[model samples]
Target: MRDSFDLIGIVMPSLLQGATVTLQVAAQAGLLGLVVALVVGSLRTTENRLLRFPLTVYVEFFRGTSAFVQLYWAYFALPMIGVRLDPLQAGILVLALNVGAYGSEVVRGALTAIPRGQLEACRALGIPTWVAYVKVLIPQAMQRVVLPMGNLAIDLLKGTSLLSAIAVTELAFAARQTVSAFGNPMLIFGLVLLMYLVLAAPIAAGARYLNDRTKRYVA
Candidate 1:
């Protein structure tokens, strides 16, 4: 018990630091992902085949491939082609792209799910296409996507563990380093799980709050 306590005392600071990095990565990635989802998803709803085809390719490619591999390709392969990103930048970029692919579907579905009559009414009122999407379709879609986007947010949080693969020193890396130094995988990893749970709780709560609030607002 004393040894475990001592280990915690020794490693807690590092873990906290790593948690901070994890939050940073997740925040940047999640925000960028939301942007990508909105752009791609909104465009996908268009009748324009030119935009749809390439966007479809992007969504399918990222969604179809492994995120871990994508991270490696960004960190390792990109340098060979004369594009280099630091570990933090690579981690954030790949995660944003990966999560964005999934999020695009959520946004697309939410947008499409809006009642057709609303769109028809917009057209009938002489609303421009961009105005209709911005004022009417997008807002309603955002309300609908709260829960799913929250799920994606949590997934992005979990996905930060992959950053360790590139030596970014986030929570999983901190845990791994602690385990290497102290040799108690079970205890250290167990704590890591708890830490992740703690981190994820607020995202879940915020999503629920938004969902409930939006539902009330729409009602």
Candidate 2:
């Protein structure tokens, strides 16, 4: 056991490097989700029947299903259908779609939360609809969503652990490797927990801070 200390030390850096993969997966998924959120949320806000109905269908589809199933579909089924991606790509793609479906609602609500009168005035002032949305509405909506989106991002980050099932060597995968090597579940999982906390705490703090300040834009 004592002799394994050197082994553990040598492995920690590799674990962290693997964790970087987890971080990259989360970041890519979250960013892609954010883009989807913007488009779907805008459509929801605009009330375009064509766009809204389809977006609604997507939201319901993802929200109704388990993320684990979605991951499996991407990893296992899509390749069979000829839309192939590596394990890492599949994990990220599924996560983005899953989270984006929910984030759209958050963004839709944030858009509605902005005072209707502001939108009215933007129209009254000859602001092009797109211009008004970009200059006035989206910023206000962003304020509301920054916190919620940050929370979602953290959830997505933690959820990356599930990727190990598909052979993605992320933080959880690294910990599992550690446990297999040393037969020390406690240490492996304990370190995993600590790493998650370390990664997520700052994002949470930033969310709280932004939430507090965003109130000023409620007008």
Q: Per-residue lDDT for 83-153 in model 1, tens only?
A: 99999999999999999999999989987889899889999999998998888877787688999989999
Candidate 2 Cα misplacement greater than 4 A, ranges:
1-7, 122-136
Candidate lDDT values, in order = 0.92, 0.86
lDDT of 1: 0.92
Which pairs of residues collide in model 2? none
What TM-score goes with each of the models? 0.90, 0.88
lDDT of 2 by residue, 3-53 (tens): 557666866886898789989999999999989988887788774688778
**Candidate 2's error at 110, in angstroms?**
1.0
Question: For model 1, where is the 10-residue window of minimal lDDT?
Answer: 210-219
